[model samples]
Target: MKVLSMILAGFVVGYAVSDIRPFDSLLSSTAEFGSPTTIVNGLTVLALTACLVSVALARSSARGVLVVAIGAVLVVVFRTVGMVTGMFGDWAGAVGAGALLGASAVLAGRHRAAQASLAVAAIGAGLLGTALDALLQADDGPVFVWDVAGAEDAVVPERAIVMVIAALGTALSLYQAHRDVALQSHETRRTLLVGLPLPIAAGVVSWFAGGHDSGDAVWLGALAGMAVLAVVAAFALPGRDGRVLLVLFASATIGSMGFAVEDSLQLAVSVALLVVGAGIGYRWPQLYVGLGGLLVVAGASLIEGYVALPSLSQFALPFVVAYALVSVLSTAPGSLAVALPALFTMSLPVTVFAASYQAGLSLSSDNAVATRTSEPDHLVLSLAGLVVVAVVTVACAVLMRRPTQNPAAR
Candidate 1:
């Protein structure tokens, strides 16, 4: 149930934040911004930020329900704006109704009254959004008659169902994190540091700065910058658990790969980055050493220009290896917590790739699929380079797990 709640929360958050709805056009048109799109985007940002801030405050030493309340208010305002400006149509009403249902669920949960109240507020916000959407598009306008025309037979709407699942998963994950998982002092700090901004900041910067030119220097420059950052982080924190650094590097690399793929680069930078990240994971046995090598590979790529790249297939190998390492070395909660943002970023390209594959199959066309690999040989070489990360993580986990006979160490 907790897992289901978490998954639902994730899905709700995703849907709320992204303008993926079919009716987004209407909402975008209604906002104070020239278009409804800007309104929706602004609202999403505000809501997401509020939620994240609230979560951060709750997790840290801050004592107050203010952050959570602020989050709830922001969500309500977001919805109210959408509805008042004709963005929601009849959807606004559904949001109210859904809030009632969600509130009931929250009260039933095991959390303290305050926590449960916050949970209820979140659910209310989600419900209100859902209801507002539903009301906006009702077949027979405003008559209160149940309209089944466009409705699915499923109890929960498809998108809502997905959000619920994600919320459940997230809740379960938090529960697990609160259980027995232990981390070394350094590892804990490293994990927290890496999790803070790398996931979102790198992504936003890359998205806005990316170029359309096939061999644009910006692409290579970003990769090089990432490499440098990794090296710096690794060296600055050269503890035995350098594997945490690799995990952080991998998350950043994954973000870049997603950006490159989403941009539809003919250069196949995604493959290269993935392979390089993987190789660091599998060999070297220390993040610092792996980072040094990564910097070299990226620097070489930047210097080599676009023409001398190798095959694309080599790129997938590193991701497979990196994920394997993540699955094996990290405890369940740590792995899930660390993986969420990375996987979320990775999903964008995976979705695009899957869609392209499906389209290719549907047309029964013989047109060769666009190559994601920059070059075959480079991919292979990079994949080999990824082994360092695996070695480092495994070795660290093993050493960390061993009993210390030395009283000083203990």
Candidate 2:
């Protein structure tokens, strides 16, 4: 149960943090409001501090203590710098600044060290949160094509502060809740070896395969890579965590592949993919896998539509189901919010395409029986896809609510 909670925490936090901040210049716009570099720099330092402090405070090892000290110094340095530069302000800033100093004093007493450490971590986290609002005011440049389409707009970049805090906090809390689940845990150690290579090799192979061979080779490679990751994670973590990864990656890969299939055959392939994906999600219930698959399907549908490969109406079902599945599957609020804009963007083409199809069908004369028959019977099938997602979502929620007894804790 603790492990599940921790994984949920990490997913929520990681998604939240990744949503608000721009990872690369291409991913964000920084010209209108002002430079985001300042806030980014500040948060980067704070995030590092939080991770260090969390690990340091929880572990009673020499190296852990050293990390804790370094983290403390970083918090002090960054907060002090923020104050001098007039970044941190008002009551929250004052409270955070005070806590920084008082935290040090509390740490001096062995009995209350954990409490003190928590305080410091809180201060650091609070400071980082403030930095996100400041970063939102950062200058965003001209609107690009994606911005107009409701895709990834450079106007508002999602920051990673929430994710970092959540991840660090969850890591710390989990470590405290179960000492056996710490950095030195057997699972963690084994994951270090398997998680490193499979995805990397898969990505490299997929990239080199390029625009030829109808995307088959790339799809197969992704499946193989995800399988490897699942095997390793299952052997190492051996529980819900491993199951989550397997489902998430497998669904994503299959959905993406379905989207990449020839437009004429999109309905058949997408249905097949959806079935395969939903089956995995049902059996595994991995949040990450479901979300990943949702994203891939959404992306592929957009590309397919753009190329005039698949009829626009053909995309509606996938778009609806994928987004709906994502919102329900992911525990991360940040990820959910980020996904909304993408959903809205994807909906436009699908909706436009559908309306046009219905109109064309209506305008056709009875004499044009061939045209009527050829009007692509994809709409009904697409709606069915949406129904599947809805059913899966309900089932997943119910499953998530069920109680599980954990003997490990006992």
Candidate 3:
């Protein structure tokens, strides 16, 4: 029952965070300054910041629940009035929804050991939500056609359904929090301040790269900058948390390469593979194996770019990404400070890929086609990011293996 509640909480938060419909609606209804890509970038930063603040401030389980509940309420309000209020309400609601997600994870997994499972569940649920949203928005029959421009208008019934899920999840999480012994939040202001800027800056860089004026040089520079920052941040942080961040960076990079999946069935299959990989990682939790999987994903992507393989082979990408992420998280000391920031950082790569590849806006094809061929430049860019991630993953692994110095011995 406890696990179920956590899953529910994760699903709600995941759905709220991943669903781009509200933002899409906001952009369409009002004259937003930037393109869809820029808005997404800003929203990602806001969500990351909100997650950090909510987790840092929620000193107890009760506070965590309260924060999450408030976040849920804000999302519900956004869904209700987003069309009416234009941009500000939608943006504010997204931030609140992000806070709810961050707080709920902390509340559910109060101990270090449980944080990995909570993260896995939450991520899987979020991916599921993304797939479901696509299916729900399909214009003809059950088949969902991918549109890079943006999803069709906000589906009213779907919005209501998501709100209900968020409410129920919040209630369940509250009940579970009340039953369990309250765990004090371990996050500190110093750590929050130190860790906050990297992901936000990464998002900003990605947003800039995604802009119409930016070219391949800007995108490559952003990728290189993010890689350096992630590696430096990983080593700068003490113990396993840094390694966790590196692995998540790799996961995000690999996962973002899947932008070519054009239909709902392929997406559902990819998400299913993600769940399987998460389960495997939870059971084994091997860092090296996960690292190797990252390499395999990189290799496979390069191969697919040049060689014509069976289209179904693409599903392996998400599996490897999820496995790598969960494996590293399982080994780390569960801290929302690390987990939430790392998770948000994961979004930067996706933003970059979307902007660089001109996803949604450029990729328009017949619904009957299951997948589209990725451009050569996009493949090369993905390979470059993945190679950097692999290098960082190895460096992190080596650093993690080193013995800590004993003060008395020194």
lDDT of 1: 0.34
State every prediction's TM-score relative to the real structure: 0.37, 0.31, 0.75
Query: Which residue ranges in model 1 land beyond 4 Å of their true spot?
Result: 1-55, 58-157, 164-209, 213-216, 230-245, 248-410
lDDT of 2 by residue, 138-236 (tens): 355222221122222232323323333444554454344444422221122223233333333333333322212223334334334434544453334
TM-score of 2: 0.31
Higher-lDDT candidate of 1 and 3: 3
lDDT, model 1, position 228: 45
Per-candidate local distance difference test = 0.34, 0.31, 0.56
Residue-level error in angstroms, candidate 1, position 54 = 7.6
Could you tell me how far off, in angstroms, the CA of residue 270 lies in candidate 2 after the best superposition? 23
- The candidate with the higher TM-score, 1 or 2, is 1
Residue 108 of model 2, lDDT score: 24
**Local error of candidate 2 at residue 138 (angstroms):** 13
Which 10 residues in a row give candidate 1 its minimum summed lDDT? 346-355
Best by TM-score: 3
lDDT of 3 by residue, 265-383 (tens): 67667667877887787788887888887777667777777788864335776677667776766322223444443554444432322322223544673233222122227475557
Q: Pick the candidate with the highest lDDT.
A: 3
TM-score of 3: 0.75
